[model samples]
Target: MSGITRRSGLLLGGAALLSAAAGAPDRPWAEWDVAVIGAGVTGLSAARNLADHGLRVVVLEARDRIGGQLYTDHGFTSVPVELGAGLIHGAAASTWELVDWAGAETVRVRSEPRAAPGTSVDGAAPPREDESAADYLRRLGVPESDWPPVSDENEPLSRWSAAWMVERGEFDWWSAPRADFRVVGGYDRLLAPLAYGLRIDLGRRVRAVRWSGGGVELVVSGPGGTERVRARRCVATLPIRVLRAADVAFDPPLPAAHRDAIAALDATDAVKLLMEFDRPVLPADADTLAWDGDLDVWSVSRLSPTAPEVVSVWAAGEAARALLALPEDDRFDAGLRALGEAAGQAPPDPVRRTTHDWTRDPHSRGAYLYVPPGAHDAPAALAAPVGGVLFFAGEATTGENTVEGAYDSGYDATDGLLADL
Candidate 1:
């Protein structure tokens, strides 16, 4: 009880198990079977799957709202705005099931993938065992004009592992781009079914995790105060930056494998700049465009023909850092200038503009992890369970750097956890 005083706390926000900080250990939390940290799609999917198997699962989330990096901005414009992950990357993406369940409207993004479907990397030879995406593009003889879209999307693709791309089925972007889509109702609607009947504790920021073969303990702090929660097993779906920042400590230290994997991945400086245009900016048939600069401009109307003429400009790496460093008043101008430059004309000023710098947000350290070349196996190593007590699931755990990848990781971790037990 002596050490418990300094860290004494009670579970906060929605989970009704623990009653008081001092007496929480002896309370109803003892009945909890699993503790899932971070209520993003990864945690939600795991919790949902566990509950379906008749397990008592409690989800602890740091933010007041759900969706870690998959936030939808309803107030940004008359139509839903995606500040985070926006597209379903492939026809085989697992998110389509959730989309159907949510009944969300979606439209195919206009793209001529590799000139036709079922081709092999635009008909070029397969990437070598140790090839980078940048090299692959060069090998394909992709025109410099066409490289902007791919280059701007993944700045410094010299770090993108070609094998990792094949594993993620992302080579299809050039091999098959017609399958991408945007959710008109927003990606958040898929949460309803994933979260049904789950006891999610929002605002519970887990600061430390202490686990052993006996069970696992988590020290979480929230608005009310701090508290400890115990469960037979735990799943941590924290973002790569959060773990790398050591925001949450692990008792006895994590193994060298996890530590090395942690160092292998890093967060990209990513930002989304949304501006409302009086009229369309890109060509009528164009679904997306890469400006001369590092920004990729696309009309929101592609999500729905009736959607407003708002165009969202996306930038990553150096461009995002530049945009984030700009003064509040100058950022929008930079986006407008990029669009105007790419479209070859300066149009009327945007009626309104909105931009969110997730890089600067404390709750979310950054957007997500990007796998550097030669470290393609980092996600698998990071996800490897520790002492049969701690499991990790996030966008980083999956080879992909997208929401669907995150969603797949959630259930994948759940399947692994079930097998472990």
Candidate 2:
């Protein structure tokens, strides 16, 4: 049992297989030791780890490209502009390891002006597990000035879980004055190393996952035609939103607990944009402008001072939904208006406007994970496998709901799969 590259000696009753259908019997069937779904952070890391350990793993990605939420718009500006996730949560974030291994440049920079620490309203007692942070804040009549940042966590207070806040420990560590770091060139640079030597099939969507005691059979659809893939073990790493949307059906249906976990967790709606300006915008002294407006504006230059003269706008949940509601052209206009208001400058319109609405995206229906009310254990429950044949990995399953958590998910899934084998 030193390694498992083929099913010759390690055939566990049935061999892993990929067979083309739709009158293509002449096509060859590809075999794999394990099949990983959705080439996001979780999927990429898991595939890389499993491959390195001598397992013939194949990553089936729904999207045309990998790096799921770690999307970078290199064409938007001179330096890469992050359309999905930007900052590495904190220096302590485990993604830094990949950055180091990839030899990517990063610096501890300020994303916004440092505000008073903690989301606690008037030093109120910690929130109960049954309530949301919004309800708690509203009950305290939290000052309107502090309403915007919710004392500094990314997701708005309404979507937050009061108990989850306590569980996350420190929000200040994620972003404060120079508390976090951004990859200098692009966060997506790590994609190369993770994808290197990995067998990835892009533009292929897994429509169904039929798992039983024998093995897991995945029905996949692509431009070519319909195909079926059978593997001894399966790693499903789709985003929570995609899972909730029922994009892929499990033949016998996932266990009740897994299904419940998928439903219980909340995914935040997110929209990001980059507006190129003639010169630097926002006050030079200010790293981020915490405004009373609906969006937050940050300097792309801060990622690398010499990078570009553009500002990045971020909108979450209702705000993101609102922006998404606007026409494609109007969305950028709205972003510019929000930026001008936040910056207190009636500056001219941007030269270029690049807007990406994650909420409206089919693949990424929302940004990342968040805990609300009483579903604290949902992440772990969702991460749990079924029949020892199907494993799961994603940020929602990690309990932390961060890039680090998503990356760690791969390790966790691979470890479990290895042990079972």
State the displacement of the C-alpha of residue 393, model 1, in Å, after optimal TM-score superposition.
1.0
lDDT of 2 at 128: 76
**Off by more than 4 A, model 1:** 1-30, 114-150, 166-174, 278-285, 302-307
Residue-level lDDT tens digits of model 2 in 48-139: 77765678788898889888988888898787888887777554566665675566787655554355443434355777787776676566
Assess candidate 1 and give its TM-score to the true structure: 0.84
Location of the lowest summed lDDT over 10 successive residues in candidate 2? 12-21
lDDT (Cα atoms) of all candidates against the true structure: 0.75, 0.73
Q: Write the residue-wise lDDT of candidate 1 on 1-421 in tens digits.
A: 0001110111131123112212322224545789999899888888877766667889999888888888888997788888888887767777776765555677777754423333345445667756777777687776544542434555476777766776665656544444578887787887766775568888999999999998788998999899999999999998888888899999979999998988878778788888887677778888777455788777775555666788887888888888889996788888888888877888578888887888877766887677776667788898899999899888778856677777777888888898888
Question: lDDT of model 2 at residue 416?
Answer: 80
Best by lDDT: 1
